[model samples]
Target: MKKYLDIISDLGEGFGSYSIADDSSLLALVSSANIACGFHAGDPRTMASAVEKSIENNVGVGAHPGFPDLVGFGRRAMDLSSWEVTTDILYQIGALHAFVKAYGGELQHVTPHGKLGNFSVVDQRYAKAIAEGIAMFDPSLIVVTMPGELAEAAKKKGLRVAYTIFADRTYNDDGTLVARSNPHAVIRDPDTVVERVIRMVNEGKVTSITGKEIEVNGHSLLLHGDTPGSLQLAKQIKNALMSAEIEIRRLGDWIN
Candidate 1:
C-alpha cells in the first residue's frame, strides 16, 4: 500500500510591493513550505515573513532556489555551468538557513524551484552540482523532488532524498512532467486534479498526459500557491486524504 503523504506548497513567492498569494493562509493548510530565496521570486523581507508564518503554523520550511530569473519567475531555463549551479544552490540555502535559524526553526529540505528543478531531473551534471552543494551544507540534508538523477546524486552523497508529485501538472509517458509550455500540461480542473491526487496516494500511479500509468508516487505533493482558488483546492485535497485515513504530515518526517 502507498504510504501517507506530505502535502507542501510554495511560499515567499512575492517580492517588493507585490504579492502572489496569501501565504499566511497557505501555512494553515500545508504541512511544509518551499520558501523562495530571492533568486526566483522573494526579497529579504518576504523570506523573513514567510519563515515567521511557517514557524507560527508549525509548517516545515525549505529553501526554494531557482535560476536567478526574476523576469521569468524562474520558469525559464538558463544555460549555466556546473560550478555556477553548485554555488547558486549553496548561496540560496545559506540565505534561507540564516532566517530559519534566527526564527528558531529548522530548514527541513532543499527543493529547487522552476526550470532549475526540472533540469536536475534529467541532466546528470546539473544533478551532481546540486547534490554537491547539499553535501557541502550537511550531507544528510533532505533533497525533495522527482525520482531521477537528482535523487540518485543525493543518495550517492549521503544526503536524504524524497520525491515530489505535482498535484496539478500532468506527467509524460517517460514519467517526466509534460512541458509547461503545452496548453494541456496543467490540469486546471480542480475536480480532476483532486481525483488524480487521491489515486496517486492510494494507487502509487499517475496518468500521463498521453494516457499511460506511470509510477510517480512521492513522499511529497507539490501544489502551486499562485493559482486561483488554490487554497480551496488544498482544502479539498486535505479533506479527502483525511477522510480516506491518510495522515497529512511534514515531508521531513518521512524523508529517506
Candidate 2:
C-alpha cells in the first residue's frame, strides 16, 4: 500500500490592506488550506478570495477559527466560557463556509487557530466545546488536531479526526507543541523540516525538544505560510515527500 500525506497551510491571514505571506504561491504547493475566518486575521473580502483561490487550485478548504484577538493574532489565550467558545467557533466556521458555498465548494475540515488550538489540546473543557461547535456545524467535517483532548473529544462526537503535526514547530516530551515563546520552538531549516516530516509520516515518530522520539500517528503535516522562506521550504518538503514515494493528497479524500 502507498503511504499518503497531506500538506496544509494557514491562509487568508490578512486584514484589509495588510497582507501576510504569499497566499497565491503557497496555495500552489499545499494540498489543503486552513482559511482564517474574521476573528484573527481575515475579513470578508479576504475570506472570499481565499475560498475562490482554494477552489481554483482544487485544494481542500478548511475553516481556521481563532479567538477574537486581532492585535495578538490569536496567539494569546483568552478567558471565556464554554458556551462562548462553542458559539464563537460556530460563527467563524459559518462565515467562512458561506464563501465556500458561494464558490460552489463544500468545506473540508476545521482546525482551530493559534492559542485556541493550543488550549484545545490540553484543556478538556475547551476540547469538548470545540468538538461541540464543529459537530453542531457539520458532523461530516474532519477535525484536524493533534493526539490530545481535542482528538478524544472529536472521536467521541463521531467526527472523523485527522491527526496533524506542525512541520515548522517543535514538540514537547509529552506530545504537545512547544510554546512559541521559546526561541527554539520553531525549526526554520528546510532540510531538517523535510527530514522530520518524512520520518513522522513513514515511521509515525517525531523528535521532541528534549531529543526524545515521540510516537505520532499523523495524517497531515502543517506548514505556515507566514514563515520566512516558507514558499521555498514548502516546495522542498513537497518534493522530498514525492521523492520518498509518499502520496501527497487532500485530507478529506482519504482520512477516515
Candidate 3:
C-alpha cells in the first residue's frame, strides 16, 4: 500500500506594504494553505488575494488564527482569558471563511498560529478554548493538531482531527515542538528536513532534540512560509516525497 500525506504551508502572512513569503510559488508546491487572518500577519487585501490564489491552485484553505501580536509576529506570549481566545478564534475564522465562500471554496481546517499554538499544547484551558471556538463556528471543520491537548480537546468536541508534523521545526522528547528560543529549534538544511519528513511518514517517528526517537501521527506536513529558503526547501521536499513513492493529497479531501 502507498502512504499518503498532505503538504501545507502558512500563507497570507503579509501586512500592509510588507510581504513575508513567496506565497504564489509556495502555493504551487503545497496542497493546503493555512492563511493568516488580520490579527497576526494579514489584512483584508492580502487575505482576499490568498483566497483567490488558493482557489486557482486547488489548494485547501484553512484559517491560521493567532494572538494579536503583529510586532512580535504572534511569536510572543500574551495574557488572554479563555473567553477571549475563543472569541478571537471565531472572529478570525469567520473573516477567512467569508473569502473562501466568495471564491467558491469551503474552509477546510483550523490551525492555531505561533505562541497560541504552542500554549495549547500543554495548557488544557487554552486547548479547550480553541476547540470550543472551532466547534462553535462549524463542527465539521478539521482541526490540524500535534500530539497534545488540542487533539484531545478537538476529539471531545466532536470535531475531526488531523495530526501534523513540522517539516522545518525540531521536536522534543514528548513530541512537542522545540521552542524558538532555542537556537537549534529550527532545522535549516533542506536535505535534513527531507530526510526527517520521509522517516516520519514512513516510520511514524521523529528524533527529538535530546536524541530520543518519538512516535508521531503524520497526517499533514507543515512548512513555514516565512522560513529562509522555504521555496527551495518546499520543492526539494515535494520532489523527495514523490521520489520516495508517497502520495501527497489535500487534508480536506481525504482526512476523515
Candidate 4:
C-alpha cells in the first residue's frame, strides 16, 4: 500500500539585501514551512514576510529555531546549558508566533534548526529542554523531530510530535544523519532522492551509508531549501508521491 506523507521545508532564511533560494516556488510545493526565527538566518522583516507568504499559500507555519550563530548559519555547535537551549527556543517561538497571529494563522509546529536540531536528537537534556520550551508556548503545537531523544522528550512533555525524515540527506547506521563534513552527506540528484523517499514511506526503512537497513518513521519528509535546485527537487518529490497515491498534507492536518 502507498504511504501518506507530510511535506515540509525551511523558509525565512535571509537577512537584509541577501536572499537564499526562491521561497515562493517552494511554498507552492510544501504543505508546511519551518520559518527561520532570526537567530540562524532570518531577521524580523524576513520572518514576518515568510509568515505572510505561508498564510497566503495556505501552508502550515512552524518555528525553526537554531543556535545563536549567524556567522556559522547555526550549523556550528555552541556551548549552552539546557536551560539556555530551552529559553532560546522559547524566544524564537514567541517571535514567530507574533507573526503567525498577526497574519491570522495559528502556529502549527516547532522544529529546531541546524546544529541545534542535531543536538536535540542526541542529547536527552537538550531534547527535553526543547520540548519543554514548546510546551510552554503551546502544548497543542507539534514538534517535528527524528526518532530519538527529541521525539521522546516531546511525547513525555505532553506535546504532539510528528516524526520527520530527510528526503535528501543520508542517515547513519545509528539513525543519525551523516556528518555534513563528509562529501556525500546530501543526496542531490532529484530522481534518487525521490526514489529514496518513496522507499522510506512505503517500506518504513532507509539504507544507511554503512549499508545497514534502518527503519524510519515518516510523519513528515523534509527537504532543505538552501540546497541547489531545491525548488525543482521538492516539486518532483511531491509529484512522485502523488503519482504513487501517497497522501501528502500538513503535519497539523494529518498527525491527529
List, residue by residue over 172-229, the lDDT tens digit for candidate 3: 8888888888999999988889999999999998899999998988799999878788
> What is candidate 1's lDDT per residue for 1-256, written digit by digit as tens?
5467888999999999999998988888899999999998999999999999999899988999999999999999799999999999999999999999999999889989899999999999999999999889867578998989999999898888888988999889998998978999888888999999999988888889888888876888888878888889989988888988888889777665
Best candidate (score: lDDT): 2
Write down the lDDT that model 3 would get: 0.93
Question: In terms of TM-score, how similar is model 1 to the real structure?
Answer: 0.97
Task: Please give the CA lDDT of all the candidate structures.
Answer: 0.90, 0.94, 0.93, 0.91
lDDT of 1 at 115: 98
Over 86-160, each residue of candidate 2 has an lDDT whose tens digit, in order, gives 999999999999999999998999999999999999999999999999999999999999989999999999999
Q: For model 2, name the residue pairs that clash.
A: none
TM-score of each candidate? 0.97, 0.98, 0.98, 0.97
Structural RMSD, model 1? 1.2
Count of steric clashes across candidates, in order: 0, 0, 0, 0
Candidate 3 residue 186 Cα shift, in angstroms, is: 0.9
Worst 10 residues of 2 by lDDT: 218-227
Clashing pairs in 4: none
Q: Show where candidate 3 strays beyond 4 Å.
A: none
